[model samples]
Target: MDQETAMRLLLKGATAFFLDVPSGMEFGIDMMSWATGDKFKGIKMIPQGIHFIYYSATDKYGNTAPRCGFFHNFKKSECLVRKWDPDKEELLNVPREEIAQYKTNILNLDQFLAPYPFEEQTKWNGLSSLLTENVITTLCPETTIIRSAMELFPASKTENVKRRRKWGPIRTDDDVGYDHLPNLVPKAESQFRFTEPPECHYPPGSSLSQITKHSLDSSYILEKMAEKHHNVIDLLAELQFCYICFLVGLNYESFERWKKLFQLYCMGKDAVAQNQGLYVKFLLAVRQQLDTVPEDFLVDIVENNNVIYNGLKELFRTLESGDFVLGDDLKDVTVQLRRFLQQKFGWEFNGLDEDDDDEAPVIINFDEN
Candidate 1:
């Protein structure tokens, strides 16, 4: 089929009519973004799935505001209408009456709509395949909008204000003269509700031995987090959700949570043996996520003392240890990931050095009478 005919058929798939967005404003769906021209109205041929629609409003002086985005699950042949509020610099839902008119005039307006970039569909699918409506509703801010600069409010309104206020007069060597600065917290209604890691490494009333073990191996915390999910796949879904939020939405909070989740999964040696299927899926997800990371960011990882490398090494050691009889599927993907890392970043996972702090055994000395 000709390109025009193919686009026409795809346009019949799903359409978004973005009305009155200023020319030269940044607009994007999924992975590709472009500066809209005077004639641009919106996007067409969007595939049927949950996709992120994001844009930044450009001012008269050529200054651009922070990017804002939201997720929408489009259905086949569905039409969506959004009007850009120039004064507020935000996308607002069009009135139902006006939406009906746009639907009627879609054929006439088709010329102004840009076709979705199908070339990115495969990459987008790899990143977002595990994302579900449940994951969106659970983690997204109550306002259902994600902004690169998250909204914040004075810390006084937060639950931890009392504790934070108590530290106002206390000065630590690390304070660095910023202690006088007023504390701010993410707006309650605008914060991503990511699952927090455990506050305590061990359960209450645990013996000294159990506490020491839990602190060294995060399997107990992993088990605690697993109880909150329907299954292990749901846990993986949250990981994917955080990655997309950080990668596409530009939310650093999501990125931090993603690292924490990755660390939890990697550090839990017992959890790995208990859930082989989950580990297989986890390795696959990690590989795909690493593939998408920018080269500059990977360089930062190497510069920051090989944070990712160390995490993967710990995981590899756990899997390779003769104690566990791991599945072939798990072993195969693990090998593939190791090979990819070696070729891509020249990372080796043979073993940690005997003199390395991580490998050295801890010794507690006691004074004897």
Candidate 2:
């Protein structure tokens, strides 16, 4: 708008000059995909935060490899330059002097490079917030570059039967037949994996048998989940990261991985019953994240039997059952979530039965966030 503000943004935003990017291939940061034209460089006023840059390289025969992307935490006014390696088919960082020169000449270069799509910034923020710099650094141990992070597994016939050609207009995955295709498996051994791999993130080797009714305390359980970490913030970040990696990133392994963890806590009937304190804290964290999940992401989940949704639904049902009991804090979080889901998504939850003549349930309120 104003000169001063424009100058500030120019100083704050980062520049990405990718040289020799192949024509006909798609490149983009976050939500915006760019089909490179004559002047193929990309310049944008990127917010100083963690972002994902991805591309799909295509050949003449219409065949393509798995979608490749990388995560970066940009600093204020950071200038990044990369040259495409035709052999590796990846972007390699340019030399320091070259980057310095590019930064100096950015005013002239602005004419050629495309501006960031401001209209898509809202959607980009929603997606990018799911993964933070710490979370990315922790989850992507082998490589932050997703192409290298992807593990190839043999696909099954069942997978082939259920697989669709397109999940959305954007081709997040390569169009290869599942039977003949290799899986784009996310690494479970990485820092993002549930402490109990393929299940809940309870302390290592801890189980329901070890957890007793007397030992149940929401704060204590949260501490256990966090362990040495200051708080459960890291755990929450991981949950959000895994979910996005699965849903938007088109990593099936990540979906299954997130589901396993989600099901472990939300759907673990005996586990939840025995450890209601832990269950409540977990749900609180999940409720906080629910707002961040976009409607499209939810639609994708709903199309796939709504595993997370159903799990939470079942948890609510269990909590309302006569046999189950919850602390005031847990009950407050559950009720708030139930009300929110009902208003937002038309999900209905039945409270204690009408026939049962009992004292009115006490209502305790907690911060939604």
Candidate 3:
């Protein structure tokens, strides 16, 4: 953006003031972090948009679960506040009266708040461009105050509620049945433990095998995939949500779930071959997300898991096949993404083909949520 626009954004930015945070607590907003200190408060001049603020409390042993944080979309000139509860080792709500007082005397409070590093605003803008207000509101309704994990219990399991830290809801079979081949359900271990399930499933009573049994054309299979709720937008949203849950929430389960979905789209020969248009659309969506992935998120994925790296290779190999055809726009996205992976991660993608016949099909359930 131009300097004039940048100045305008800074002038209309918001403030986030955290109070009573203990020393050694690793607190962060977006990709930045600061170890707590006595005089430290929070971040200021935050651009008006959706942002991920996360923190990990360190115990005596220095262990952190990293499964806590929240997403918020700030209105222009908003002053958001939170206080750390030492006893609970979590951020707690501040009283409305105190909030009002703090805002009224924000000039005094400014001394404690840290200015957002203006030099990083350009990078921040790139990282968060795709995280629109509508997307954040649709995915996270409790934006003002949401935790990565909240404890809850079913009516029958109320006695055990204390032991359960609910990350999210479990999915039902109907929500995931579309991905399976005809009459074949995945028998994988811990199948019930997926953080999130496949967002696309086979059409009602129709599996890949059953659909292929009829020898349907690509357009017909695309129709089948679209018969349910697995349109391109829903698929992209789930993809974006998974990345946030994994990178921002620091949830491994979400990382695994996302990888599985990525693999399903990029590796599932039957699906890709039968629904080329849908596959191309998904590839485009992935490319769009890859463009705006936060620096921290990209670092985490590259350092922690090679899932995306390997997936990219697989996708390129699949694209090279004569069976799959890409238009100019889709081809540009694929080429650009491949180049980005290479330049950013210093890894060459050789487009090596893989034999998928021997691989085990994954199956999982999904809750309506």
Candidate 4:
């Protein structure tokens, strides 16, 4: 290439960190900050503005893979090359596409493709790789299954297959007035659900105000589950997603009751964006709490996010067992939590033994931050 052409190319591209990262993110001078801690090394600018990054760490383990998170911009503008000099402590730029097929190396591609299981990865980063790496397309095995389940069946036989069907009028269990609810909505068939707790010995510990409120709320979730189950029988008309709806009902029934009292479990899905952000943050914090939590953190199912916390426990167990289980039941997810609590917070709470397991489903929630 001509000198001017080479110079332009080199300037737009430069290595900012030794570790792999997303392409298309303008490292500017903040390349080191973009990478995870400890992996960063240094960068250099080749002639024509091209820059190469160097790292002290290498594949000593014969790590046949390169780990990277590319900072890709969907905007199709060709990026300017860049440079970083330790002496000047600044980043410089060169013309676009300075390096030839930068993402082609097999190792780099593998790292880019490895973060997630085959599920959503395809629709996200994996799809992007389609342009550069053809070998990764082998995921079609699972893709075919998903395709058949989501689309193919529906297209060919709508009557026989149904997952998206809506059923049962939405009833308000929160403080809202049931009378004011849409006239067609289903009414609560019974004020309470379930008989006396199975003959299990009662758990020790009286209710803290928080736990009390949670217990009450959990009782409601259990009631709802039972109601959902019965309603299925009445709506007897049938729905394509009947099995899925029944699954939800079973989970509700499993939530028998709790020792603590709880308030109505109410969270509205307002169309407002600000409210949405708060909800998202609340859910994330809830998940984080579950990750490293005390056994007693479970104030009650109603007060906390049972769906996700239960999911995490099940995931932990699944991981421990080294068997990947695709599931939706929340309570069953407790298989791992039992062991986790026993190990991490062995305060020795009693009622969790056979009596409780036979009497009713256990309710757990992570402690507040």
Provide the overall lDDT of each model, using Cα atoms, as 2-decimal numbers: 0.81, 0.62, 0.60, 0.27
Which segments of candidate 1 are over 4 A away from where they belong? 1-8, 154-163, 166-183, 352-355, 358-369
Rank ordering of all candidates by TM-score, starting from the highest: 1, 2, 3, 4
What is the C-alpha lDDT profile of model 1 across 89-179, one tens digit per residue?
8989988988788777777887899988889998888888788787788888999999999777666634445545555554554775664
Quote each prediction's TM-score.
0.88, 0.65, 0.64, 0.20
lDDT of 4 at 313: 35
Task: Give me the candidate number with maximum TM-score.
Answer: 1
Runs in model 2 with CA error above 4 Å?
Answer: 1-7, 127-131, 153-225, 228-230, 264-305, 315-345, 351-369
Best by lDDT: 1
Question: Candidate 3's residue-wise lDDT over 187-290, tens digit each?
Answer: 22212222233244444577779655433222333344334333544544455556666655665555556666675566555565655666666776565556
TM-score of candidate 2 to 2 decimals: 0.65
Write candidate 2's Cα lDDT for 1-369 as tens digits: 687876677767987788888777877776678777767877667778877778777777857666777778888889989888888887888889999999898888776677666787776665455456766776764556654246545445444343433332322335444333444433433323343331233345556765432132222333455553334556555666666665446565565656655654554455556656666667765765576567887878777766766667656655776366667877887888888888877776555244325332222111111
Q: Report the C-alpha displacement of residue 205, candidate 4, in angstroms.
A: 35
Per-residue error (Å), model 1, residue 29? 1.2
Cα error, candidate 2, residue 72 (Å): 0.8
Off by over 4 Å in 3: 1-11, 59-67, 117-129, 132-201, 204-231, 267-310, 322-325, 343-369
